[model samples]
Target chain A: MIANILDGIVLGLQFGLLAAGLTLVYGLGGVLNLAYGQMAVISAIVITLALSAGVPVLLAVALGLFVGGLAGLILDLTILRPVYRLRGEPRVLLSLLLTLGVSFIIDGFLNWRYPLETLSLRIPGEAVEILGVPMRRGSLIASAITLVTFAALFGFFRYTSLGRAVRSVIQDQEGARLVGIYPHRMLRLILVLSGVLAGLVAVTRSMVTPVDAQSGLSITVFALIVTVVGGLGNVAGALLAGIILGIVSVIAANLIGTYISLIILLAAAALTILIRPAGLLGVKE
Target chain B: MLKVKSLSAGYQGNDVVHQVDFEVGSGEAVMIIGSNGAGKTTLFRAMCGLLVPSSGQVFFEGTDISGAPAERIARLGLRFVAAERHLFPQMTVHENLLLGANPYRPDPKTMSLILDLFPRLAERRRQHAGTMSGGEQQMLAVGRALMSKPRLLVLDEPSTGLAPLLAQAAYEALGALRKQGLTVLVAEQQVPLAMSFSERGYVLENGYIKLQGTAQELAANPIVRRAYLGVT
Candidate 1:
């Protein structure tokens, strides 16, 4: 049980990395970021394509991340910005519908262009033992990289000029405008960061699972569940809640395998809703 | 200096402020007073570049800044402190204070000067602005506007929700700013005891200036007495 718990810590860290960016998008802008899963998919595809192109592996990964960010900017400019120009719930509802259309479009285009087998990358075979734990070298490495990156992002948001501008826009639009901080600039930043985060997830996913054209919506469900179950507008809270939920499932898997994991997921989600409808760390009105 | 000529503005083209004309020279104070639906706020919003006029122009500092973006207009040393907006409720009070100085970020010396100007804010500098009393937050809002070191300060209604003493204090602060050569334009329902604090004020009703004169001149008018001063 103790060993399994330790293993679960590593797993929890992975999910935290994957979900943190999505959570921040939701927290800062109140957008569900429906296309976030595509970030991971595209990152993986870019890495795979670079390898096929004879590019260096590290360069391929960096390019993959860049691809994700570019995709975020494109989505912001093309899809999200138009909807954002509208007012209130309609803005949210329209983006949800439009991004859903975009998901289908992206999936179809990827399917048409790349055969499913070409995109899959099996784990670079290696085991690394650390802190008395044996873990997949890729998972450990990605997890470590993610933890450090998120820490830096957290620090930036907590103590930087631009981050404060973004936070001001999120906290109160009029107040930000009162100080002459343009919400439009913050909106653009949101889109770019969304791409960066999505790309991070995509890179890690390519290493672990085969990404089919149909894979976009599958992981989105999990990210949504993580975001909502954590909180609607609190990134740090989403992390805590995501990791907690991650541990719950991992423990269930080690103790009872897949059967009990679903039960645990359902039960924990229900309890979370019953206890804190605003998620664990959502700002109260 | 700010000037509006034939300024006509409204929500959705309904024409609330009808061909209004006004000007505030440097180191001058102006006020607009009106009852509900008189379009006073709309005129203020329009003059400050928040609302675009339908068929008119606004020139600030002798530049045709009509239809300029609100943020850009703010950057040009004309700042508007809106009524009843509390932007960052969840952050610490210090955080809100720092944001006021953002556009002027290159000048930390201005920030200290701003703090010195509003000593009450400096004392509670570390407190969360949201938790502050209505009066304190209003002061913070105005102080934040001062961070930009605006040549012209436009306040919608500094007296709303404040006690008489607090309102007087707020007006006194405006007086001090005006004393230091900052142009001020205030819109309020209650006439200050002396408009001595302000050089001039205009009374608006039904989207036009019902009365305009030196602050004391308007204050002494029979119409002004009935409309605002409640003099029998």
Candidate 2:
């Protein structure tokens, strides 16, 4: 039971990273990029392909991460910007469709490239024993990576000028503009940051489980659930919600079956919607 | 210093402010007074570049700023405090004030001055801005704008919803800022209060400037008194 719980937490922390990206985009751009998961999957694929081409693992991972940032920038410039000029329900519906369409295109290309194969990272380390628990060395490393990344993110928002500008834009676009902070420029930075985060999640998760081309959709769905359960645009909520969801899923799977986990997730999301539409930590606008 | 030449602007496809013209010299206080929906806010929006004018130009310090983006205008040392009081509610008062000074390296003296100007805000400096009362939030909005030490400060309905005492207090604060040589362009619906502070005033009606004069002259004009000052 402890091992199952630990596994769930490991998965949850990685999901937290992905959900944070999604929430940031939605908060700033009001766009739920369905292509978000594809961005991660593409990073994984790039690393795998580089390794196959005789590239070292570290260099391949670096290249994959770089692509992630580039993909985010491209998406922002091409797809999200024009849609953001719109208002009301039209803006919401249109951006949703546009991102979904992009998701399909990415998924199709990835499927063509990899077919039915899956990719996994092989770290050269032995499992470690801690307090009577035998832990996979890779999981321990992934947790460490998540912790460092989260800390860095916190520091960026709290201390850096660019990060503060992003926060101001998220709070009120016109207000930010009045203070000489351009929302569009901030939006670009956010998308790039989002890409970087998704890339990190890709590399970390691919270490533990095999990631296939079709994995993008499931990843996107899980992240979306976590974001919703946490609160739409709340970063801390996403992190907390991710862990809770992770624990609940594992417990549900243990008590019933793997299929019951989905039911549990859906229920949590439904309860949140009915009781707290703004989300647990979402600021009521 | 600011100048507006035949400025016309509005929302969507409709023009709410048409061919309005005005000017304000450096360190001068000018008021644009109008009834609700008489284009005061709309004109302010165009001047700040939140709305592009359909026709006309705005020059700030002789630079043609018409159609320039709001951020660009703000960078040029003109700050607009919208009447909505768009404070980052989740953030503390100190953080909000810090963001106001974000364009330039923040000065501790300016923060101290703003805190002095709004003692209520200083008392709640550590509190989240959104939790404050409306009057307190309004003060914070104006105080935040002052954080940048703007060359020109534009206020939209600064005391629109406040109690009479709060409104008086807000104007007194502005009066103190004016004494410090802050060039101000204020849009107001409260005719008497506005005229009391401004050296010059313009009366806007249906998107056009119906009258313009020295504050005392406009205040004493029988027509102005009957129409806007609630007197026979």
Candidate 3:
């Protein structure tokens, strides 16, 4: 039981970094960006390609950040901005379809170029003792990175000018715009930020499992589940939700099996949807 | 300091206002009176760049800001306050007021000036704006807009959801703002109160201006009385 809990804590912290930003973006924008998952996929692909091309690992990571930021900009220009302009439920539907289509397109291209390969990253996945519990070194590093980034982001939104602007946009778009915050610019920046975060998570994942086209959709499913379960737009809430869900899944995989864990999480999400449409922390609008 | 000529705008792909000509000089208070659905909000929106005008000109301080984005317009010291939807609820009153000054990078002293103008707000600085009384919220809304230190302040229904006395107090504040050399264009449904405070007024019915006169003339117009004020 202890080991199962430890495993959950490890995985939860790692995944929560990606999930928190997703919650904020979805809450503010009011659109589930189906393309969000592939941001991670692209990051992994970029890092791999760069590293394979003899670039230093550090440079390759920077290259991943650049690629992720670029993808985010592209998503904003091609998907989110237009969706915002469309101005109705149609906008939500359009964004959903558009993002799904984008993810598929990216997956198709990656599959065509690379074909089927066990695309995994090799790092020292050594074991370490943490607070008297044994943990994987990769998971420990990923958790630390996630926590550090979240702490930084927390500081930013709480104290900075741009952070307030983002909060204003999230709380009230028109008011934010009225205060001279260009929504398009903020959205672009937020999209980039969200994308970069997902990219970072993918980097952590690369240190664990082999990634492929399938992982894109797979990760998206879990991320969306965690986001909604936490509460649609609450970042801290989403992190908590991610951790809870992560633990559940980890335990289920250890006990019942993988597919059953996925099933249970989906079932709970559906039940939560029926009871509280906004999730745990989202405001009822 | 503000000008709109041949300004026509509406919701996407349709025109609610047509070829409207109006101007508000520096330190002037222009009241826009209209029945509901008569295009007052649309005009205000277009002028402020919230809604893009189909065709027309908007000049501020002699700069052609006709098709600039609303945020850009706001950054240049023209701010619009949609009275009902004004306050950022979750934020503290102080935070909400500070947000009004957001378009500017950050001016420490401007905040004190705004809080000084609305001492009631200062007293309730840490309180959540959403939980504030309607009167206080409206004050916060106005106070927030002033935080930008706007030369031209555009207000939509400043009297909305206010008791007569509260509205009067709100108008008194608006009156004081004009006294301080700020240009104001107010869109109001309350004609008698509006006419009393404003120097010049425009009467709009169904998206077109039907009358332009000094407040006294508008108040005395039989048609305006019969149609708008319900005065027999």
Q: Which candidate is the best by lDDT?
A: 2
| Per-residue accuracy of model 2 over B36-127 as CA lDDT, tens digit each | 98999999999998998899999999999999999999999999999997888888898899999978877999999999999998899899
DockQ in order: 0.59, 0.83, 0.62
The lowest-lDDT stretch of 10 consecutive residues in candidate 3 chain B is B82-91
Instruction: Pick the TM-score winner.
Output: 2
* Candidate 1 global lDDT: 0.75
The TM-score of predicted model 1 comes to 0.91
The DockQ-based CAPRI class assigned to model 2 is high
Q: What RMSD does model 3 have?
A: 2.6
Q: Provide all candidates' interface root-mean-square deviations.
A: 1.6, 0.9, 1.4
Docking class of 3: medium
Tens digits of per-residue lDDT for model 1, A165-267: 8888778876787677887778778778768777777666655556655667766766776666777656676567667777788888877887887677667
Reported per model, the fraction of native interface contacts reproduced equals 0.62, 0.85, 0.66
Please report how far candidate 1 places residue A19 from its true position, in Å.
Answer: 3.4
lDDT tens digits, residue span A1-285, model 3:
878887887777765776775776776776678877788888888888887789998888888878887888888886666788775578778889989999999888888886553336565755888667877777777777778888888888767878877878888888887778887677778888888888887877776677765678877887888887878667777777778877888899989988798898898789779988878776766
Candidate 3 overall lDDT versus native: 0.81
Predicted chain A of candidate 2: TM-score: 0.95
| Residue-wise C-alpha lDDT for candidate 1, range B73-166, written one tens digit per residue | 8778888887774448766656776787667673678677767767888888778777888888888888878777888889888887899998
